[model samples]
Target chain A: MSELISGSEILMQSLLKEGVDTIFGYPGGAITPVFDALYDFQDRFNYILTRHEQGATHAAQGYARVSGKPGICLVTSGPGATNAITGIGDAMMDSTPLIVIAGQVQAELLGTDAFQEIDLVGITQPISKWAYQIRRPEDITWAVARAFYIASTGRPGPVVLDFAKNAQIGKAEFYYKKCEFTRGYIPYPEISTKQIESAAQLINDAKKPLALVGQGVILGNAENELKSFLEKADIPAASTLLGLSAMPTNFRLNKGFLGMHGNVGPNMKTNECDVLIAIGMRFDDRVTGNLKTYAKQAKIIHLDIDPSELNKNVKVDAKVLGDAKVSLKLLTDAIQNAKHGEWIDSFKEHEEKEFEKVIKKEVFPENGPIKMGEVINLISEASNNEAILVTDVGQNQIMAARYFKYSKTRSIVTSGGLGTMGFGIPAAIGAKVAAPDRKVCLFVGDGGFQMTMQELGTILQEQIGVKIIILNNNYLGMVRQWQELFFRKRYSSSVMINPNFGAIADAYKIKNQEVKDRKDLKKAIDEMFSDDKPYMLIVETEKEGMVYPMTPAGDTVTHILLGDE
Target chain B: MENENMTLYTVSVFSENRVGLLNQISIIFTRRRLNIETLSVSPSALKGIHKFTITTFSDADTIEKVVKQIDKRVDIIKAFYNTDEDLVYQEIALYKIATDQLIKLGSIEEMIRTYNIRILEMNETCVVLEKTGHYEETQALFSELSQKVNVLQFIRSGRVAINKSKIERLSDMLANLNSRKPEGYVEDDEYAGY
Candidate 1:
């Protein structure tokens, strides 16, 4: 039986049909109909209101990343939709699944520039996976279903649906049917057995095989498959930044993170491997420094769901296009259990050298301003290495990526490809919403935190219990570091003169603490995470502290400087 | 990197008819800093679907990425890139010249025979000539006519292409989608409650 319902009701019904129980959004003029309908469905789903549209989007991203579901955000037209562009682009670059619904002016006023009207679909088309404007009330259910389907499908990214005001209030015969098939859109491509067999053969014969895992493994939920494949093949694995926490930190064959500021072992030993099996990770420029020489000596086998990423950057010997969970299991079944003792030992040797030359001094410095690494270590220990670590971009992010030890998949959420600052707090709110039972910790730099610190109001309103740790270096630390090393220490406009964060937190009526000494670090962290309410900790760190084991621009991965020259 | 001689690639996209899709597709080209040298949109063989033929000067790598991004659109059925050699393509040009000038030159018949042009219409003041060929061929004919007569107006339609392969890829894709169940749909029993 079909019931006649308003377009707003159709949207709410469609969302419920898709198994969505929560949405992060902000209400405004054009979206009144949706909000009115939401008022009736309040008992079915929870809507967490954020201060700004961007905050809602990031929070949705946080929820998506942690829950492995499409995060939903709703906002009104014009400024509200424009403000969300950054988050949409961030989700696109990071491959996060998000559905942003922006209300528009009446359909008649679409191009006439009516009050609170913008071409959101046109603006967001390039950045989003799919974008469309709903012109008819009859199409509401179908549009909502399509948005969810496109947003959460293969290589998930953000999708936008712009609903005209007339459609929202107009009546429609609503039969809530989830979108199953889009005419031209294929969610999953068929895997070729021949390609998998060739990749398996290469793995079986290679003496020194290294696995470069990316966030795709987590996105595909192939953690167990990846573990089994690594164990069976006896291959050493390394993670890209977003790929962190896919493998448990203490996994025997897991050789830490790999990139410009990554562990010395993975970056230095990338060229030494005979075969590089890239699983679910695109070779971004940051991950592969100087592509001309990146893993040049290795025979590469790339396994990914997206066909475009196969030879986009680094040329590969064999390509297996399919979901990671399926392809990895097939490769594991085709290969024999073997061990490369000496090859693994070589990576260990490099790790030890890095620890002796860089990690020891940077993480365990004794008599100076509290280092960023120490702060991350204290928080990691206080949370028992189990908290979901959300970080903003800059030195704070790189330091946290280096110091925090993750024991679970989907535990670390950061803006990876977009390198978006102001991402931590709102995303941490989303993570807390998605996984309320787990502890959520946000590590943000002072510069990045100030970009979206207004989200403190969001935390206060929602009572989200996220632990906020601000690494205050009194400057845009990452840019400052770059200037210091490469540009004769000109400093530029990186210096940020700021307000007292503790006072700001107090104004928000949330608990706050400050740590300038090493003695206060652990206790402050314990106190911050001790309460279920949101708390902010400001840690003063040395201004000139730089991320080491750096691969200068235009240089090979192997040519890395262990320390500041 | 700043080479002048970049190969031109023709990208064809098959999509369902929707407003603003052209704007969306054009934005991708704008973001990549690639200019669309020519573009044409018309109904495809499919009843409700449309085909967009776009030409841009870029390398194979960039064109491949553009096609992949275009394919990501929900309404887009499929997008493919082809080099000049892989497809047989043609463009039509319409030229309007002063009737008095053409008659005075007394070379309208000679020009029509030489360039394989057709007279679309004629009036007391002007005549319209249609030329169907490659872009360069059309341009060359227009130049010769202009040198001899007073050209009042000149317009060219974008390239329309047909792949050398016998089978239409879009037909195969649509058939494949038809053979399968719609995505994300649950059984009727499962949807009874919600």
Candidate 2:
């Protein structure tokens, strides 16, 4: 037997062995044992005390997305675990690798309905990759190792480890072994040569091929391989919302974003392309628009690590089921070189039409109230596309995604699949922690910012150097826009009577500015980014602003509404 | 993943017996709106492996998806689905009745001969009868007994199934893995793979 150690100490050792130096969490009654042990282990760990357990999870997700390492978050039982459910669901949808440890009531008191008790494993089971309860101290080492392995492998996802209080205090022999190959859980499926050859054959023969990329390219670390594949074949590619920054904004073959509010060209070309190659993306309904109409003319090829995702949304003619990092190179090698100039030019025509009609007005407005896109576009220009663009959900997120440019991979951090508001502030802090060298600029709506405004305390406490740009339209703009379009402009509970954000920032002892005029906008952004410390730039954006190039609900991907007409 | 093309499919899930593993597997079936017709859990031939035998009605598409999801669980070894034609199955049931009520019916030996049941235990107050057969066959005896005399206690085991093939799928998979294993390859721990 190895030397006996307390359950809490086993957790610390297990975490340390997994290369976790930074921890994001909230401590509470059931989890006090772990926190008490962490006090002695402070010299080796950097513990971030998030105001809410929910914030911790989103922060962890942000960190994971940026660093390519599984984020570790700890929360107490009961309400603490329940609060973090949204983030867990968000991580599941976006494929962010996170290890969420929720403290549970004592093992003996598990079914007694003890104080602060929660059935954490039961609640988290559906959303998480795995939910295991550690009722005894001895299970810590194995569970932690397994959690890390299961979380960070294949299509990465969140895993919850429910820790009972008794287990935290109990003593047991400690030992840890890194998991290499799990018996049934195959993270990396064996790549098939037949599939690769077939994929190559289809792509080589296609006259009009469009590559619809997703975040899998970034997660698989196949950005270079993807670029090489696209360049070799000279195929125009567009990215899903999460798939942004997999290829830089200005790459020649990189068309634009895809989805409902995405760039017009990519949305239209999706229907036109005779052959659609989807890499590392599930055909999310938002991206596909309508099942019956989406890519009906195209022979679809899907490449992903998860077999379940292959026919989940769209049927694939050729399925390359493996890590795209490995498969893309093989696919590139097998395919014969070709060009689709005329096919590519068709996409360009639609894009040019979009630029003339919508992009110009959104990004270069000279008069009237300040536009969200204008500020985003200018910030991209100001940062020289070097800063990471993080956004909270709703109008701000779409505008930021549309206008903000990128120069690097893992640069776009936003809650895509589970569009959780208030994801901005905490996620930005996590992003800053993951990439201390890079500038993390966050664009959040006033409605979303206040949702997790308590995280502002966390920023001040840690002095995280992140630039926050709150697009204060004074309304929940996304819903308001929806109501305006579909609900006959009856804005029911969409508008907000808010507080002084500048005052809130001052109370937190952080530098802040409110930009109401266009001239002040540039200066305010400059001031926000001038210093390394936390800064919030509150921009008074147009309350009536709408995100356009809309594919009306159940409409075809190609038929987008450019304006009210 | 549920669809209208419903058919009887037996989904066998092999896993390490773990806390809440049964609940996790059941939840998947519930989410797909597939009702479990019969279920059983028992240790497998292989050490440290537990097998869950579940019978449910679902199309091939839904079952395939559900099996894939079940296999994705951390401790699960593998999951497979097969139609009734692919496997041989059986179930065991027990019936306990008052001796006085049973004696009132004439030709007790004739009843035993026709129903294919054996007496497990006989006491002053009650007699226990055991029957092993498919679900319908067991149910037929249950109907006859309930009409003749009230059953003091009745219990039925879930369906236990084995593929009609000569070799088990798990054994085949292990053998294939062994043959492909590098020369002189040794496991770090005997139970680690499980």
Which of the numbered candidates is closest to the native, going by highest TM-score? Answer: 1
Per-model interface RMSD values are 4.1, 3.3
State the DockQ, from 0 to 1, for candidate 2.
Answer: 0.42
Model 1 DockQ reads: 0.53
What candidate 2 keeps of the native contacts, as a fraction, is: 0.47
Q: Over the stretch B102-183, how does candidate 2's per-residue lDDT look in tens digits?
A: 8889668977898889999988899999999988889899999999999999999989999895566787765653454446
lDDT of 2 by residue, A1-565 (tens): 6689999999999999999988999999999999999999999988999999999999999899999999999999999999999999999999999999989999899888899887888888888898888888877887888899899989999999999999999999887777665566778888999999999999999998999999999999999999999999999999999999999999999998999988888888888888899999999988998999889888899999998888877878999999999999999999988988888888767888888888889889879999998999988888889999899999999999999998899999999999999999999999999998889999999999999999998999999998999999999999999999999999999989999999999999989999899988888777777878899888999989999888877788887888748
| lDDT (10s digit) by residue, model 1, range A350-447 | 88888888888878888888889888987898888998999999999999999999998999999999999999999999999999998999999999
Clashing pairs for predicted structure model 1, backbone only: A180-B182, A180-B183, A180-B184, A181-B182, A181-B183
- Model 1 iRMS (Å) reads 4.1
Name the candidate that leads on lDDT.
2
Please list the residue runs of candidate 1 whose C-alpha ends up more than 4 Å from where it truly belongs after superposition: B1-5, B180-194
